[model samples]
Target: MAKYSDEFKLKVVKEYLTGKIGLKRLAKKYSIPSNTAIRTWVAAYKAYGNNGIKRKRSKEVYSVQFKVEVLHFMKQTGASYQETAIQFKMNNPRLIAKWNQKFLEEGIEGLQEKAKGRPSMSKKSKPTKQEKEMSREEQLERENELLRLEVAYLKKLKAFRENPEAFLGKHKQSLPLNSKKKDSD
Candidate 1:
């Protein structure tokens, strides 16, 4: 995909908005690759005015509250990812989709951005402010997920201790068990 400067996009949008030409002719005249780009620009301009035509930076950090608000609006309106991104002024719609996936799998906690590299501090020493303020239901859900994970880890550890050879078998994908021998009558 090609990047268009705000000036170029605004020019195309202004030409289209003049009512003197349609999108196809305007795109050809301006040498824009996609007529869809013009249409999107027009829609964005109409919806958000000059700011809509301005290009967003390639990468941005969104707050968890912002992510949650977007998700809630999406749920309330049943809007598609593209629609949500447009409404929220995001250049790429896939971001809203990834946020939605994280929200679904990990709840609001998943929306927060994690540290990029190795952590200097351990999370176990103290609860974060967010954790401290968590509602009772939210806390229980988090604890439940943690307990389930711990159980699975213990189960795997037990299997590894019991049958190191079978556990390391090619089908380790399933569980730690080796095929038991069948006794013939």
Candidate 2:
């Protein structure tokens, strides 16, 4: 995939907006992969203007009015977080929580998308040192079990060789069963 700069994207959008060049020619000229990309850029530029060219880590922030509308919906409908999430097409509960908290604290301002970074409160649970040590111990126990089985197998083989009759049981022969004998005088 090629990473076109914001400038390159704007140029393409500008050229497309002029209606002077075919999408194929523009794509070929800029070595863009597909007409689809050019078309999308043009559409975005028309809708959002130059600001659309800048890459956003997240989708466009919900406006204060939009947030208020959602809050109103939540209040009027008495919808739960899940219901609101489904209605608004938002998947993140954290985002919903933030919005709820914001509604309670700063009202509509909290509903605005927070700056993209690590959350103020650490949400990830770290493994304790004891848990890490236990995992290591469990791994060692598995290895020791395998070693014990191997040692037992070797010891059994040695014992069988030392006393073949014990291993073969009653199948042991009394002699070669083919011996020459002299006649008695």
Candidate 3:
């Protein structure tokens, strides 16, 4: 990827602000590979003025709390991905959408970053031979627990039909999670 200087970005943004030409013309004139870059730059400029469009020094690592807050803000404002990304000064608006998707699937824990690379085998306790041959109900329960958040709500609805008692049982109490909404309204 070509690394454009902050000065060049600023100049392009200034030209864009003048509204003399559209993104395609500006990109073609400037030999930019894609007009998307200009669009982002324009949004960046609008949100944070000069600072938003500036190239970042390094990859940012957002805390879970920050992720939750961003999700809340996006939901509260009913903002588009691009708009939320602009407000957050994020280079990619798609990231906000990804965070929202994960948040929806897994609750707050979905925001937690997993360890990079292969998972440590040492951490997992190998299941006993007898434990391996679990009953259909047990297997379903395990699978449900593993991907409860990743799968759609319809799957959970199916689980309810399979075993209404299990779905309404102490399973929820065993894995305690705080689900209180923090409304920014």
Candidate 4:
């Protein structure tokens, strides 16, 4: 569709509102593609004033629930897309039409938000049998190292319990500054 400036839209809308000319004549006078465009613009102008004819800079994101509700309202009331949009205070009636098309084509899943942008290049590949075996071996090694550290910790704990003063004396030089202060306290 040809993009019309806000000023141009306002001019067309004003002319249409003058009660002299109809939609088809105005469309022909302005060389618009269809009378529906003029009708949509007039309806939007009536509903939202000057801001209705202006183009939106940022796209709006509608929730899946909201889309479903809009479709449901359209279905129950048997209203046209433009009427439904006006009733729901939505700016874009064509958006409701697209949502309806998607719903019909793919059911609810079609109305769901799709991820945009390029797909990730670093997709993970499935591990081979050899790679899985190596992972298992590495897991066992990690477990063994943890068990050794645990045994060493238990031995040191037993020595500390056996002779607290001796343990403190032996490790006093190696202790942290805070630990030394705490022991002194």
Candidate 5:
């Protein structure tokens, strides 16, 4: 998506507010690909004023349950992604569309947050301040997920230890290559 400066957005919004021209004309004048952009801008501008057109500095993280609720509301009301976002006071409407797509493709689990950035090469780092202040329910949910992972890991470890050859054969993707054969004494 193209990023427009705040000045450009304000200009377009002001022109739109004049009621002299429609969205299509404003879009063509600005050489924008779609008039939908103008419509979105207009809605945001009317709803939030100058702050609406301004770019967000930090990313907002929504809870999985919140995403589910948003999806359900959209489903129940049959509202467009933009409308749903505006109702929820969210700046980015496209994220709701993305969540809907993920939910369709992978069920509720798809809405779960995936780890961002490169995986740690060392020991697990301590939780962030935000995580530290997580609600009791959230903390328990996180702990449950972690415990499930640990149990699965231990089970696989046991299986590998019991019969290395069979376990490696069964789970080839877990290891890139087999170890070289040991020399006989």
Candidate 6:
């Protein structure tokens, strides 16, 4: 499907109104795909004038002032997201949230609608100060505990080495009879 601009639609409508040529001729002259397109344009023009030639209805871009007012109302009234969306006639609560967050982060400049793209992950990935501190403390505690265990193990090993026989008891059942004979000789 081809999209016709308002300007092109107006020109075609004007030509059709002039009655200088038939619909088929006009379609051929303008390289429009079919007579149906020309007829539709003419009908729309006759019914609604120039405004009808524009694109289909779309959401109007909210002005910066409107965004500011909405934010102010939210701050003053402490309204829930649903309540605010209902009041503003906005079906998508997420849109309001996006605007509010943008406004908070970058003021009115953030309210300007941008082309859809990959959403940022910075907010999700960045760690909070409290989390960082807690992790650091936990790591230090683990290291200290490991050191304590290692010291205790080494101390036990040193004590065992000093008195090996005391730790490993002697069982002299097989003391070699030849050693007794040699000692007698």
The number of the candidate with the highest lDDT is 4
Global CA lDDT computed for model 3: 0.70
| Per-model TM-score versus the true fold | 0.49, 0.33, 0.55, 0.66, 0.64, 0.31
Candidate 5 lDDT tens digits, 1-117: 448988899999999899999888999998989998888888888888888788776666676655765675577557899888876777678899999999899876687779878
**Which segments of model 6 are wrong by more than 4 Å?**
57-185
In TM-score terms, candidate 6 sits at 0.31
Of 3 and 5, the candidate ahead on lDDT is 5
Question: Which ranking of candidates, highest TM-score first?
Answer: 4, 5, 3, 1, 2, 6
Q: List where candidate 1 sits over 4 angstroms from the true fold.
A: 28-31, 56-60, 80-94, 101-110, 117-185
The CA lDDT at 61 in model 2 is: 48
lDDT, candidate 3, at 47: 80
Please report, in order, the local distance difference test score of every candidate based on alpha carbons: 0.69, 0.60, 0.70, 0.76, 0.74, 0.62
Query: Cα deviation in Å at residue 110, candidate 2?
Result: 26
Please give the lDDT score at residue 21 for candidate 5: 92
Worst 10 residues of 5 by lDDT: 175-184
The stretch of ten residues in a row with the least summed lDDT in candidate 1 is 175-184
Candidate 5 residue spans exceeding 4 A from truth: 122-185
lDDT of 4: 0.76
**Predicted candidate 6 versus true structure: per-residue lDDT over 1-185, tens digit per residue:** 33878788789889889989899998899898898767766665665677545654555566554555456445545775545554554443556788899978986557655768797676557899998999999999966765664465456446556764553232122222111121111
| Candidate 3 stretches greater than 4 Å from native | 1-5, 31-34, 89-91, 120-185
Q: List model 1 lDDT by residue over 54-123, tens digit each.
A: 7664546665545655675577557877677676656556678899899789866687678687868765
Off by over 4 Å in 2: 57-185
Q: Give Cα distance to truth, residue 76, candidate 2, Å.
A: 24
Model 3, clash count? Answer: 0
The TM-score that candidate 1 achieves is 0.49
Model 6 residue pairs with clashes: none
Q: Residue 148 deviation, candidate 2, in Å?
A: 54
